[model samples]
Target chain A: MTPLDCVEGKGLACVRGGRTVFRDVGFRLARGEALVVEGPNGSGKTSLLRLVAGLLPAASGTLWVSGGDIVIEEREERGKLIGWLGHHDAVKPQLTAAELLRFFARLQGTRAQSVTAALERVGLSCAADLPCQYLSAGQKKRLALARLKLCGRPLWLLDEPLAALDADGKSLLLTMMREHLATGGLALVATHDPIDLEAARLQLA
Target chain B: MSAFAALLARDIRLAARAGGSAMLALGFFAAVVTLLPLGIGSEARLLASIAAGVLWIAAVLANLLTLDRLFQADYEDGSLDLFALSPLSLEGIAGAKIMAHWLTTGLPLTILSPLLAVLLHLPAAAYPALLVSLLTGTPAISAIGAVATALTVTVRRGGLLLPLIVLPLLTPVVIFGAGTVLASIDGLQNGGIWFLAAFAGVTLPLSPFVAAAALRLNLSE
Candidate 1:
């Protein structure tokens, strides 16, 4: 793990719908680290992750990710460096689980073989040929995580990663995340659920 | 496959599925063209004279039927958010979808126009002109409709607003498209086809940028 691998945001402020969502949010995480953001409802936990993912523009502060071979400064271009898991599963009902993963894998420019591996990793291999509309909600969350894994980005911006996850799914995700951190990847997770990970915590009220 | 091709293939597959709206557009186009003669009376000469215009109008409206969902479906499903995060530029994503819209709606409508024109007793001499004009002009319709769809994508129940914004912009396409067939019927050499082609030429290339800009606004907000 390169010590240079990390994400840093300083005095980050976000405005949405003509109102400030959050302000002066700052954090720095070096390689093999995770930051858990805890907050009440409407406290902008999701907004903070979105801000870092470059999906939302910072109204007041500077946000940048430094690590890997190249540094990303542009907000829009930072998506190339992030694997985002928002509240929405982003699954199409018409597509089978395997097809869904393959599509995302292709979009991520990952190898074709990774689709099968990701499905297996998420315990979705048996249902891989089944259409997503038939999959349960927790299964869908697993599918999203599999997509997150397929992205292979060094930084993960996961929003509510624990939502709708069964116990097995939860452990599976934690293990995958731990593996990610072990491999020099960092994560900023936004969640209400308390997780068991040796990580930094940031609270928003 | 590249992201553009992956998105394009998925969209086309969805449209081909049952209740995908692609067939709905084609069926609506056929029904409108078929029922028009019954409403306007069975005067063959009159039908022939207006066939180009009426079919063009039906084709335009039919192309519009499926447009509202172009970006709305992706946005609602949150695929669009992920797409924005992907390596593909928003402009490239917009372009691929515009092409998909053309493939499913515009291209199919073009193919079906002549069959419906037969019901209107359109002069066989103008058939090639009708095909060529639609081949050139309907792409502009798809392109322009894509931008309109993207602009209204964030609005709940935006389908009702789509035609109001799109149809007015399509006046020239309908005019030049129908005019090309009309001119062909009269054996006159007019610039109608070239104008139609030029309109498509301009809008097809420009819609991606305009739609991408709209998408950027909608996505960030």
Candidate 2:
């Protein structure tokens, strides 16, 4: 696992669908630091996080993670450093919650024990055996949270992490985010809603 | 279990759960083979003559119908991005998907084709050649078809567009596959089987990389 000391991008710019989303955006984040990206809809908050995650290549500029430059197919960077939570729920409706977590654990090259631990942590033990199709929207978001915690990556790129979450679900995520920061993990969360935590804010116009 | 094994197993299990693609392809293949007698003349000599081409064409189209399901489901459910994040390379994931696709569709078709050959009035002498040709040819079709399947994964109605792209690329496999059986009936040396094997050999390794590259393009878009 990479010990995250700092992630800083220089002059970041994003282009999508032949239009520039954001240009000349730059920042540096270190261990135990959080950056909450706030912006209006279509203002490139999600695009910014995706660019850092290497999902969307930056139109220009460099994103450096722990002193290593971001590359699209770098397995070590993607597998160990980045844990992404995009808008679309990645869980398969056909697989049971436990089965899905186990599959993800295997994909992350981690132990299956983390799957059970994360499920319990997220209060999903009761619904563990049920297929994801039966999961309500809130329960499905919790499942995605369980997967993020279970994977154990050092950097999180969360896009709208609180959408569809209940009060309990929101608190659970805040705790996870806190624990992640305390343990030297870095986070860049994009949302238009208020996050009641002490975080460095980057607002995109 | 290894990541590749898990992915391959999961894909096959999912296809089995989907419940229609593999079974539908089989039903379609059987119907085409069965209807051939009515469409053409019922003469035994004529049926025997065209049996090779007819059976090969049916199997190809039947297999083609399921190709769209290969990557679209993963792409839609957002697992494809998670797959890109895994320790396994995209190429490895593509290979696992294609293997699962072959196991469910191509492998079954190859096994069932010889049985359908009897309905087509295929001579007993041509049976072994038919089996060998399909065994070599099916993997090539799966591997090559996967490339086009991955390309159209982002398009909404790409399933309908699959045949347009795939049929032209896989025409050689069909030609070589049918040629192997025809050469067997004519009491001539069939070098076509060697060409069929070589096509499988070349495609099985190379196509996954091409498919993976296309999927990455789709993911970023």
Candidate 3:
């Protein structure tokens, strides 16, 4: 049941904009565990997450998720097992929260949830019918988090999940992470702030 | 059916709910077609000669206007990344998006071309030829536009650059499309439809893969 056993990376490097963001970076996460990637603004935390999520190629090493090696050949299969959320809330502004969640659920090949349940999980139940463009900043972040609840994937790659949250929103997210890990789901969250989790720290310098 | 249907349905619903860009594109197409005959002299022979080219050109422009939104909005909102990461390959997503684009922009343009043709004083017999050529050519427009849209997703001023990149590539389509209608008007239909069909067939399969690759490069950047 070791988290590292299920998720692992080795000698991973990423370059962007004619500069090497980080090189030889590596880490792992497992069920019932969380790995917090702490770094400064330009320290390649998001790049590392993208590499792990198989969104970008690693310059040098390999990433493995849930016992599957993340080579080019296994990318499609690996994608199904990873749920990634970046700092930019990717929700379509024209879509109601309900429609957005339903579309994403179908994309992930999962049954659509009661939008009520998903929205309520992120404290967005009252705004479920509202298009995302009209939601407040924190509300938008919550709407993005609601995707995590809807997809129910085992691995979560979150970049600064707590950036725009108020205190209550942060607490709600912390609780969500605990619940996720308690259920044998793993999370790799990249952030600057200290997250209240009994989690291992992975510093990307 | 296949996952392609699901992707198409989702995009069409998204497009429909978002103020119906397809119908709006058709409206633009009609407006452009109507204005051309007014701008130029309305002599019957002149209109008949230029009608197909004008209609196809207007349709291509209208399609380009809506093309930027094909990937730009999705990329801005982060749904493009999600689509990229889907179990469906990027090429599959590109194909679905192109189909949606054609359904929204191209199909309406083709449907409305005949109406515009009449207003432009085009010969009655040329209507069917114009329609057939548009049916074959507009998909190529959508497919080629997808490649440009994907390439310019991360670039600033992509809206302006879209047509600049795509229009040159659309030369063959315009040539064949306009040629087909003119040939019909001249009572010669031997090669135009086949040429149009061949252009569509070749571009449809090839453009999606190129678009997918371009999107991957843009995303990775």
- When summed lDDT is taken over every stretch of 10 residues in candidate 3 chain A, the lowest stretch is A64-73
Q: Per-residue CA lDDT of candidate 2, range A1-205, in tens?
A: 4666788889999888999999999988988888999999999998898777777788898877763443434543554578888888888887889988998888788889878788999999999999888999888889999999988888888989999999999999999999999998889999999998788999899
Please tell me which model should have the higher TM-score, number 1 or number 3.
1
lDDT score at residue A115, model 3, on the 0-100 scale: 60
List the candidate 1 regions with Cα displacement exceeding 4 Å: A1-4, A68-70
Winner by DockQ between candidate 3 and candidate 2: 3
Better of 1 and 2 by TM-score: 1
| Cα lDDT of model 2 by residue, B1-221, tens digit | 38898898787766676464678778889999998898887898999999999989998998888888789988887788788877788899999999988898888888898899888889988988888888889889889989999999999999899999999889889999999899898766569999889889999999999999999888776
Docking quality level of the chain pair in candidate 2: medium
For the predicted complex of model 2, DockQ is: 0.56
What TM-score would you report for chain A in candidate 3?
Answer: 0.91
> Which runs in model 2 stand beyond 4 Å of their true positions?
A67-76, B18-20, B41-43
Report the error of model 3 at residue B90, Å. 0.8
Which of the predicted structures, 1 or 3, would earn the higher lDDT when compared with the native? 1
**Per-residue lDDT over B111-196 for candidate 3, one digit per residue giving the tens place of the 0 to 100 score:** 87877888878888888888889889889999999999999998778998887788888998888888888889877876978988
DockQ of 1: 0.70
Over A1-205, each residue of candidate 1 has an lDDT whose tens digit, in order, gives 2234768889988888988888898999888899999999999999898788877778988866776566777665678778889889999998899988888888867776888889999999999999899999999999999999987887888999999999999999999999999998889999999998889999987
